[model samples]
Target: MAGVAVAAIPDDIAETHKGIVQLFSSTDDQRSVRESGQAIAALDESTKARHLEMQQSIKELTGVTNRMLDELNDRKSNLLDPTTKRELLAQKSRAEDNIRRMQEDNASLQNQVGALSNKATDLTTSEQQIKQREINEVKRAKHTISLYANISSIKWDYSSPNVKGWITAGAASTGRMRAFEMERGSHSDFQVVNHLWNLMDSV
Candidate 1:
């Protein structure tokens, strides 16, 4: 037995198939994606605005050049004298120079904007680090307070040689008084206490 051949789909069926493929597409999803992209674009709106302004300026320069050419063409039709034609050409040359200067200024403005954006990012990072440090300091203070409260309940042996060091250690740990001896430049818990004592004594 021979197998039947397959036939090509008609144009109407193909068009209907294309419509069916898009039938399940969600407008809400497309709108959400577009809004997300626009939010990202808004973050760089300042830079985009500057670039747009520069582009507009270049467009204006082009317009000026075209107008000058049109004016020259009109003057040629009027059969103006050579002196007047020379003056118009000089004006055109000045307009060209202005365009070049505007382009250079645009480049400079872009560089300045980049520098400012970088500086802002650096400052933001620094601010966050400072805030984290402050939060850590507060947490440390609270921990010290809880530790002291628990340790104060204990009846320490003042007669024991090994336990005698607890006097200074306990004072430093509780943040009540500073330790007398320095411990290098480590800035550890005990070392900070020693530094505070040094500052007080110096004053």
Candidate 2:
């Protein structure tokens, strides 16, 4: 027991305790450094993910731009000049207006054609009516001439000249309207042409 207590807590005891405290401080510092390294690695991973998202956004924007360019090219090919898209629009508007005017003109022409057809029909009807009246008049005169041939009569002296057109040689009155008689002499002043025309009209 004297040997054990003789050093009375030997000088190395304090030195040993100091060594242990330094060891624990060094271990805690190392653990802090390792956690900081892990946090830095995580930050690097997040940065890479954000960069990938930005690249995808750029790709989508480029696709939209390419589509717009293609549409512009298609419209450009249908025109004569590429520098005048507005001019092309104006020309298209003018063409539409001209088409509308042509349609109106076609309608007017159709109406005129219909009117002309109606006028032609009216003229034809009137001509037919006049022709029927003229035919009836001619028929009446023919009947008068036939009746005059059936009878022998003495007629008064005619005052008109040149009755030969209505009076034939040896003519006779065959009806009440007949005025000429059988007269072969050229000295007869015959004007039965007027009387025959009047009789035909009356008949």
lDDT of 2 by residue, 53-172 (tens): 766777778788889999899777756565677887889999999999999999999999999999999999999999998788656744565566343222334454433233222424
Candidate 2, residue 67: how far the Cα is off, in Å: 18
User: How well does candidate 1 score on lDDT at residue 196?
Assistant: 42
True-structure RMSD, every candidate: 32.7, 24.1
Using Cα atoms with residue i matched to residue i, what is each candidate's TM-score against the true structure? 0.37, 0.38
Q: Residue 33 in model 2: shift from native, Å?
A: 77
Q: List the residue pairs that clash in candidate 1.
A: none
List pairs with backbone clashes in candidate 2: 147-174, 148-172, 148-174
